[model samples]
Every structure is written in C-alpha cells, then in structure tokens.
Target: MYFISTSSPDEYSTKVDRMIGENMDLTRDLEFWMSKLPACLRALPIIYLSIPGSHNSFTSNISGGSIVSLDSPKILQNLEWIYCIRHIMANWTKNQNVAVKEQLKAGIRYFDLRVSAKSRENNLYFCHGMYSCKVEPVLNEISTFLETHSKEVVILDFQHFYGFTQQTHGKLMQMLLKTYGTKLLPYSDHMDHLSLDYMTSQFSYQVITVYRSDAARFGQPLFWPSASFPTPWANTIDHNALFNFLDDKIKDRKDNVGFITQIVLTPTLTDILFNSCTTLEQKLAIDFEDLRTGWISKQTPGRRGVNIVIGDFIDLSDNLFTKTVINLNLKLLRDLPKRMTSPIN
Candidate 1:
C-alpha cells in the first residue's frame, strides 16, 4: 500500500518540477553525483548503494528504417514487413529517449543492454523491438564517459543476446575487452566486500560488465556472470502488480550481489494495438509517472532495499527518474555511524 499518491500525471510532473527547482543545488551536480557522494556511503558495498539505470539504454536512435530484431515477439517480426506496422513497433519498442553519453551525464550508472548480432553482418546492435545503433559506438561512449569521471563506477548489464554464435560471443567479448581494457572490474566471489572506495581508489576499476551467458563463466573474469547481478523482470503492465512484484523481489533480494528493480510497465499486444497512435512513453511512462515516483521516494538503499532502479524514458521531467534513484543513497547517511562500526560482511 505504498502507492498512496493519486495525483494526475500533469500534477505530478508539476510537483516534480517544483521539487527540482527547490533543490537546484542537488540536481545541478547530477552529472558527477557519484563522484560527489559522501565518503561514508562510498565505503559501503556497491550492492548496498542505490544506483540509477535505464531500461533498453540504447533505443533512442531506433527509427522507421530499423529492422525488427529476432529477439522481438514472433508476431512482431512477421508483421514488420508492413510499412506502417514497423513504425508502430518502433514507437512501442523504444524505451529510452536519450543517448548513452547523455544517460551517463544524467547520473545513470547501470545500463540494461540487450544486444543482437545482425544476420550476415559482423557488427552487433542493441535492440528492443527494432535494431538500434551499433554496439561499438555505444560502448565507446561509455568508455569515454568513464575516462573523464574518475571516481564514478558504471554497471553494464548485458541482459540479453540473440542470434549470436560461439564465435560471435567471442567477437563481442573481444570488443568489450578492447573498449574497456583496464577499466573493467573483474568478477570476484566477494562482491559484497567491494565498495566505491575500494573499486576506484584501491583498484581504479570503473566498469563492471555483466554478461548473461555461460560463455562468461569461462571467458575473461571481467565478464561477470548473470548470477552476479540478479535482475528479475516483473513483466506486467498493471501498476499495482508491478509494485507488489517489486516489494516481493526486494524482500527476497540476496546479499552480496546486485539487484535490479525494473520500474517499468510492459505493454500488452492488445494495449499496443488499441493505442497504436500513442507511443509507449505517452501511453505507459507518462501515465505511470506519479505512482513510479511515489514508489521510488519511499524506497531506501541497502542489502534488502533497492540496489539499481531502472525505468523507461529516463529523461522525463528533467531527469527526475535518475535523480530520485541517486538521492535514495542519501538515506544511508542516517546510519553512517552504525555502519562504520559494523563489519562489511
């Protein structure tokens, strides 16, 4: 029953705007917020820190020309031959509205990347329903961001892969190794012992690459296996159901690993077919703004609380989604004294 706010989307947006206006000091530094976090909080395990992320982090460039990805529903793929249907698919499939660099600058530390290898093509691409920009350029963008932001850490979650062979996975993994090089944090059994301070100061590790395949197990230690970051999808469009699902997931979250709470609504075929004229942002993201914020504001950051909270259209209301998630870490400050005395394990 945490969702008590009954405000309309416009009313909630206005309220958020006012809140941001009032807290200009905090919002202004979002570009480097991680680097500016209180030292005590930085010393805590990253699993216990609240981080901001984006769902489908590379769909900003998907357009009418983009092809329906193999990972999309079979029905979507079959009907994509129709011109208008492809555009409609793009409308519903695009989950993010900004580029990777912009997301990084907006304090998004976790990136939910779903990659796919194009048939007869050597390059890999990010996709939801339609293929987005090539993966290399986006990876370059993240590496560039990390170069300038020395103390900041980013989690690159390779959530899904499609049409990739063993050789293709090798190519993609090589691309990652070349792009990140020494910046990557190798997988460790004691992830709970890793803190921002330990990562940045002790080892200078800035990027944690999570690959969700068995290939990651035998490959470079830099490619963390899916078990390291347990991201369970609620896969529901109902707001109440999404909230309840998150509550259970958070309560059951395991220690010593990253947990992702996808604060998003999945559109059903019927919902999309009935509202073909509207974009997912309009039909789902904007409509759920009030409830999403209400739920986010009430959450805290810890082993059993929200670790990484991701959402669609993260640039909405002046990057309100990222700001709200990042601000949750401030709650940890209240228990700084007690935490300092306690053992990290």
Candidate 2:
C-alpha cells in the first residue's frame, strides 16, 4: 500500500522511503510482514538465497551482503560467530516451539534448551552449535546425539570451517550425497534474505552442511513479482514487469554457454528504486534493480557445460564487484525500504 522513506536527500529517486508505514509505526509493520509465514508454508518449499536488498530505514535491520553476491571482507574471521548466533536463534526458536509442543503431546521430555551463558564461555563463539572453546568435542557430542535421536539434525556450515577451499566445497557436496542418500534439500529459495527456507526443508538428521556463496546485492522491502497482480508497490515503477525488461541476452543458443565477466552498474539505479517513495517498499525495489543490473543472468551454452553457484564470495572474476559486509545486526541497524521485504517468520 504505502512505502516508507528515509531522511536522505535522494529519497525521491531511491524510493527507499517505502520502508515507512501507513501509520508510521515501524514495529507494527515489521510484525505484520513477518506474520504472513504460515500461509507461504502451506505451499511447496524452495531454495532460499538471501542477498542485500534495499534498506528499510523504518525497521531494525540495514540489510546488505547477500548469499548470492559475495562475502564481505569483514567476515574473513567474524562470519562464524554471527552466522552461528543467528542460525541457532532462528532454528531453535522457530522449531523449538513446534518440537516442544509436539513432544509434549507425545509424552517426550527432551525440550530444546537454549545454550545458557554459563554453558557458553564468554568471548567463546559457537558455530552451528559448536563452541569455539570446544569445537571438536562439541561436534562429537552432537554427532552422538544424532546417532541416538530419531529426528534429523542438520549442522550447516556458514563458511566452511574445517577447510572450505573450492576442493572442500566439492568434497562436502559429495559427502552430503553419500551420507543422506543423495539429493539432500540443499536449498529452499534462491535469494531471500529474511527467511529460513534453507534449513526448514531439511527434516532429517542423516547429514550436516556447510554452505557458501555470496548474494550480489541486498535488501528488498516490497518487490512486486511479475506474477503478482493488483500491484503491491502502486506508487512505484514496475521494473519486475518481466516482459518489459526481458531482453534476449542469450537468444536461442541453448548449446552455447557464457560468463558474466562484465556487469554494467547503472548509477541511476538508486534513483530508479526511490522514484516514488522512501519506504521499505521503495528501497527494496531499488535493491532488486541493483541485483538485476549487477548480477543474475543466463548461462552461456558452452562445450564445458555450466556450473551455477548461488554465493559469489567475491574473487570469482572480480571485474566490477562490490566488496561490503552484508549481514544483519538487528539490534544495531535500521531496515531500509526496498522491492522485496524479508520474508515473515
């Protein structure tokens, strides 16, 4: 309906102001958006990849660096801690309630417990459940738990810790297939920063995973998909009007493969995003537009075949890449307006 805007001078062109709400209550808007989770789950599951969308200044998170883009230089050593905290909190909270309720009904007593501060030594970080102070032992313990537990327990690696070279990624993929009987639910949605689609689809304990990739761009507060009608961002330009923007960059060359070594970054992208408002809705649109301009294109039909990767992690050809840390510190940052808002809980 109404997109929010920021106090920035360029709010009109960026449309990031869409983050503002109909009533100017950021918290209410956030809750309202997150509350729509169950309805989406009733349908099928897809791989979820999150990149930095646009900022919804009205909210608590200033999103950036997405899984589809590239990992920021800041995360050289810090990613482990941030990802661990987020993954546990999200996974535990979201599933804990369901697990506890179901177990209580079934007469089970093993409620999921939060890692007490006492249990977790100060300054000692835990990645996907492994405390830095006790990585090997903790992993062993979890491995033991998996052996005894009936349900599946997935241990996802944010940045391959035990060795994540290109070689390691391949090895890990192979191991997952061998351990889980092939075709593990590796992804949920392609590029959604605010949802848990990646982990939720995994309802088993036969395997664990370490995911890698970079989201080229980030943030999206209000993205009117090509399929959605009546238009969500009524006051904004419909760049996602797929047909209008669709150009045959690859034509009908199904037999030839190509590489996106060059990306024409349009400086006008910010203006396009906020063409109308400065709400989360507007910033999100701009972020999406940036993502489209900077990355995400067709594969060239080539003799060697194509290998599609979700995360960019930078270093891939490095022609015109944005090197910025794009994670959400919900407490420290404010959300911006954009085309696609983070998914609801």
> What is every candidate's alpha-carbon RMSD to the true fold?
8.3, 20.0
Estimate candidate 1's alpha-carbon lDDT, on a 0 to 1 scale. 0.84
Candidate 2, residues 255-280, lDDT tens digits: the string is 22211111211223345334322332
TM-score of candidate 1 against the unseen true structure: 0.90
Task: Estimate TM-scores for all models.
Answer: 0.90, 0.21
List where candidate 1 sits over 4 angstroms from the true fold: 1-26, 341-345
Which segments of model 2 are wrong by more than 4 Å?
1-140, 152-155, 160-164, 168-183, 186-210, 213-345
Candidate 2 has a TM-score of 0.21
For candidate 1, give the lDDT of residue 171: 92
Top-scoring candidate (TM-score): 1
lDDT of 1 by residue, 1-345 (tens): 012133576654454454444444444588888787655567788998889999999999988778999898788788878989988988999998899888888988899999998888888999998899999988998888888999999999998899988888999999999999999998897677788989998888999999998876884888888888888899899999999999999999988788899999998888999999989999889989888989999998886899999999999999988888888876665444334423222
